[model samples]
Target: MTPSPATAAVRVRRAELSDLDDLVALEQATFDHDLVSRAQFRRHLDSDSARVLVASANHRRFLGTALVFFRKGSRVARLYSIASLPEARGKGVGTALIEAAEAAARQRRCQSLRLEVRIDNESAIRLYERLGYRRIGPVEKGFYEDGSDAFRYAKTLA
Candidate 1:
């Protein structure tokens, strides 16, 4: 089934404490390795260097989440994590989240956005490539808790 027009109208916004439960559930549902704990999420939610963006439908229900990290005195920002419900995949939700992350990074005066993805995730790699991110260098060994390697990618913001 396809999403309704209303469901397709996803709003990306800064996440609040109220969305903690949904964010935790999303993390569990989306990854098998390198999971972010609730405590870590809480810390990021409160951290000045990190920004959490949530994609919501009807401004009430969260469909996806993305986290971006910025470093002081650095021009590069990291797209730390992003995930959408299986039902929301292929519906432009992930793209929306990425665009939001880039915007957030730009707002913070970042010159580029970077992210690391499992080397085996071809679909995600394609998505990143389609969005103008390119591989920065050789894949890193043991990048995840399960020892999966990852490819680092980066995009320069206009």
Candidate 2:
């Protein structure tokens, strides 16, 4: 059953080491190849500049997640990943996770937020546009090792 917005029971919070399995599963389900390894995820979890946020329902069911990395000298944060379970799409979980990431970036005094979306990912592009992100440029093919073109987007927070 889908959870309502008021009682969605979905909470967005920092991912702990124990959440590695669920985070990896969600990443694999959302992307093609290039799935992040457990070791990579653990490293991010332990890093001060990287963050992984998870959205969970009923405090147990993982619904979605977003990964962000902040560059120390540039004051620019990159949104590395944002994905929601297929069944959980359109439930506002992705939005919540993104807003959380924005808050986190702002907390770190980031001046802008950036991300790259696959050229064919219309839904994600629309979501980012609606959230005030604008396309900055396009990266050539083979950017993802899957030959998918990527569109870069950025939003100035400061």
Residue-pair clashes per candidate, as listed? Answer: 0, 0
What lDDT score belongs to each candidate, Candidate 1 first? 0.90, 0.84
Question: Which segments of candidate 1 are over 4 A away from where they belong?
Answer: 1-8, 58-60
Tell me, by TM-score, which candidate is best.
Answer: 1
Which RMSD does model 1 reach against the true structure? 4.0
* Tens-digit lDDT track of model 1 for 1-158: 23335335777889899999999999999999888889988999989899999997654588999999999999999998999999888877888888889888988999999999999999899999988999999989999999999999999998
Worst 10 residues of 2 by lDDT: 1-10
Q: lDDT tens digits, residues 1-158, model 2?
A: 23346435567889998888998888887788667778899999999989999887755567888999998787899999898889878767877787778888999999899998888889999889988999896575676878778899999985
